[model samples]
Target: MAGEPQPSGAPTKGGWITFPFLIATMAGLAVASGGWVSNIIVYLINEFNIKSVDAAQIANIINGCVSMFPILGAILADSFFGSFTIISASSLISLAGIVLLTLTAVIDSLKPAPCENGSTLCMGPSKTQLGILYTSLALSSIGVAGTRFTLATMGADQFDNPKHQGVFFNWHFFTMYAGTVVSMVGFVYMEDNVGWGLGYGLCVAANLIGLAIFVAGKRYYRLMKPQSSPFTRLAYVIVAALRKRKVLLSSKSEDYWQETQAEGTKFVRTTPTNSFKFLDHAALIIHGDTNSDGSIKKQWNLCTLQQVEDLKTLFRISPLWSTGILLSTPIAIQISLTVLQVLAMDRHLGPTFQIPAGTMMVFVMLSSSISLAIIDRFLLPTFQKLTGTSATPLQLIGVGHALNVLSMAISALVESKRLETARSYNLNGNSIVPLSVFWMVPQLVTVGVGEAFHLPGNVSLYYQEFPKSLKSTAAAMVSMYIGIAFYLGTAIIDFLQKTTRWLPNGINDGRMNNVYWVLTLIALINFGYYLICTWLYEYQNVERKELSKSSPYPC
Candidate 1:
């Protein structure tokens, strides 16, 4: 009765009923996050009098922390607190951080004196100011870590059908991007035209509204209880395997420790496969390894066959996972560099209106949102109808990889042209290039389209393949790699600054085009690496044939 489907049309705790609240909450948080994060580079340069390169470096580090802290959040959600608790607590933390940030904007003592136009002598923020700024950033980053992907897992958990889950993920990303686009355009405009105090005050208001909506949905949610730590079980398998290194291999299913369900239910026994055979030792039954009733006797010295296989699954998927790091690193580098590029180029749309440098990324978010909708509504259906089978996650990811390489190539060419235009005008030493900033839009749109293909693909692949017990952690893996990529991007910039003239403090004086070219090469190499990883990888949870039949737009 517990696992059986509810009767048709029966009332359910979660379904489309929770959609409005969840989507609203997601949009609200996205606006709040994008408002501050998108403008931070400009804020530091204009308000704090930090150098352009130094501001980019600081932004990269903050992005890294925001992305990386999701693992800790996921761990806590999976092992102790359920997603609801984490989301609630994190929302409050975000509100507090946003309030503090608003205070800094309003209070003169909290930031450096405004730098005069064309003046090189500018005072930086004091230690006390920097400390407060860092504290607010830290709190906000922690808040983002907890709620971003955790919300995805929680929303997906509401449905029993994988097809519905996949659709939800698509819309989830769409809502996120749509919110970002709004912030990039509206809030950034506010910050540029009105004042930082009003812009940040709006972010604080959005956070409060989002938190209230999320709390209002408590009754509609089908909340999953926290389980024992999946990481601990993974560790047990490793420890047990090493301890029983001398044990002989077994081919018989009965030799392995298998778990049995309820008495009335039929239990299917599974044997360890030949892949990663050394790990099979952990599942091999030994004296005193289990109690008389088949209960685990020593947690570290013995593990279920399922536990061993879960660890193997992680090992097998690791190469594919590693490829994501390289996949995202180039994008990270382009993001920070593009901000710098927009600053030096003319951003005017007409004689009366000029585009804010911070709002330039709106192109990426807009493209990604539109692309996601098109993919879900048209492309996927067309592909399925033509082939009588759905496109696989790996196929989508491969396409994304190819597109990313092209984006980098285009970025390099565009940056080169910008430099040429500057030289033609006899520009030097932080002078604005005569070229229009729209030149960067093509590459930004390209990367955005690539993200639409790969980001949800990666999340879908991990969620479907990972052990059910580690679902929250699986969703957070994307954040982890993105975090690593941001840090890697920072390191790459630092290395170039120290060793070469590729990334000078004043980007106009440096060969920024060469930097983009290097990223293009790196992306090409990484794409090749991704191919190899996908070639050898097999789907562990969903069979290829079954997956094709289930959903036209599977993840």
Candidate 2:
């Protein structure tokens, strides 16, 4: 596998192959870790008594916290621990969580009682089940946060610098989907059919394998130093932007001179313009009458504070991006809530029909994988060529979400019909839907395209907007979006079941029918968010050469 034994002494371009493999290994681990939780939603709902929405909330809290933690993980990875130590530590904690889950599952008395929904019988377990689950989830979150950033950075490491990495950047995402392709099958099977103890035990084993793979390749992998303090600097930018006095611009003809005193030296703002004190750097061209000679004097100062604003300003204001990702709540629900909902409904998927609740995920990810191959191999490039703008990722996302809007619209419609039938009968593995089970396949495929588009969008967008100093921070944006989307989805579903149409006889009321529509509404909101983000996108790219400029660390 190391290819022709490396010829003992000869130098090789192994970096190309080795670096990518290492990254894939890490990405694969991330997928498996996450898949464990994703596949468990059904178990939590059916065997454990956790309700559809609450189960989703539980998954969201765990997954979201892990993602949110990366902000800190980035801090730690950059400053104190470095990628190796932090990633290792995170994996161990997650391992501990898996161990605990297994032990508690075996003990039985330690498990949580299912939520108090009248739809199913309530079973008693240990009062500590909930606590143990929370602890396990939190541990997994920490590991996930740690793993996510390093892998992306490591993937980017395969390229000499960020410049030539553009195509690789696209491949990076494709490989990530590749890992999902595997986990979608492997983890889903373990979580659903195997039950909790062995299911989590396998997760632990997979993480161990993943960790070993990382350790073995430590010599080949690259680790970058943390660029800057996100929180501290963000705070500084906000205070500076708001607290500083505003500067007024003055202009004139003969010898046109404008000045402001700052930090002492009669600082010239630009080579050709009046001084503006507020901007760290400013560029301007001024018209001035030269004695008997006509000349236009231009001044430019690479004003850091004024022109670029401070990176901290990003912290001060983040509404649009946050809300936009929040719209993706259904994504989180799909893995957690929807998986459970699908499992509980007495699927009629027989030899010609039955779709394993967890196993179906492989098809879901397969759709994404095929979509990725098509997009990276064809669709995105083709779209980019036709659009004449470098907005490949956004274009796909916008279109995908539009299709998604329609797909969910169908889900909402189908679910409504299904629910009416659900009222009189409890659906099971052998149960039938009013429409053929095949109808759900399109919904699955729609979710798949959204997966492909959204994942790449998060990766590219963050990498671009984040200045060189904060590329690692930029990497975490995907996790953050996933987190927000998951939580918001849960909130919306909960709101619907508890507050509106589903309230009296709503899906949340221990019934399968109500859960479907709640998910439908969430998809609609997410679609709206997707539309706005696509429209407002000021698509940008990071030149590979800038990678050398941004990082003092070696790739």
Off by over 4 Å in 1: 1-17, 157-171, 219-222, 246-248, 265-268, 381-389, 468-474, 547-552
- What is candidate 1's lDDT per residue for 339-454, written digit by digit as tens? 99998999899997889998988888878878988988898889899999888888888889999999999999999998898888888767899989999999999999999899
Superposed on all Cα atoms, model 1 deviates from the true structure by an RMSD in Å of 3.2
Q: What is the TM-score of each candidate against the true structure?
A: 0.92, 0.73
Q: Which candidate should be chosen as best, given lDDT against the real structure?
A: 1
Model 2 weakest lDDT span, ten residues long: 281-290
lDDT of 2 by residue, 248-320 (tens): 3334222222333467576654333222223321312122312234332222212133223334334322544
Error at 329, model 1, angstroms:
0.5
Pairs that collide, model 1 = none
Query: Which stretches of candidate 2 lie above 4 Å from their native place?
Result: 1-21, 24-28, 112-121, 163-176, 220-223, 241-320, 346-355, 380-393, 423-437, 501-555
Q: Would you list the C-alpha lDDT of every candidate in the order shown?
A: 0.87, 0.56
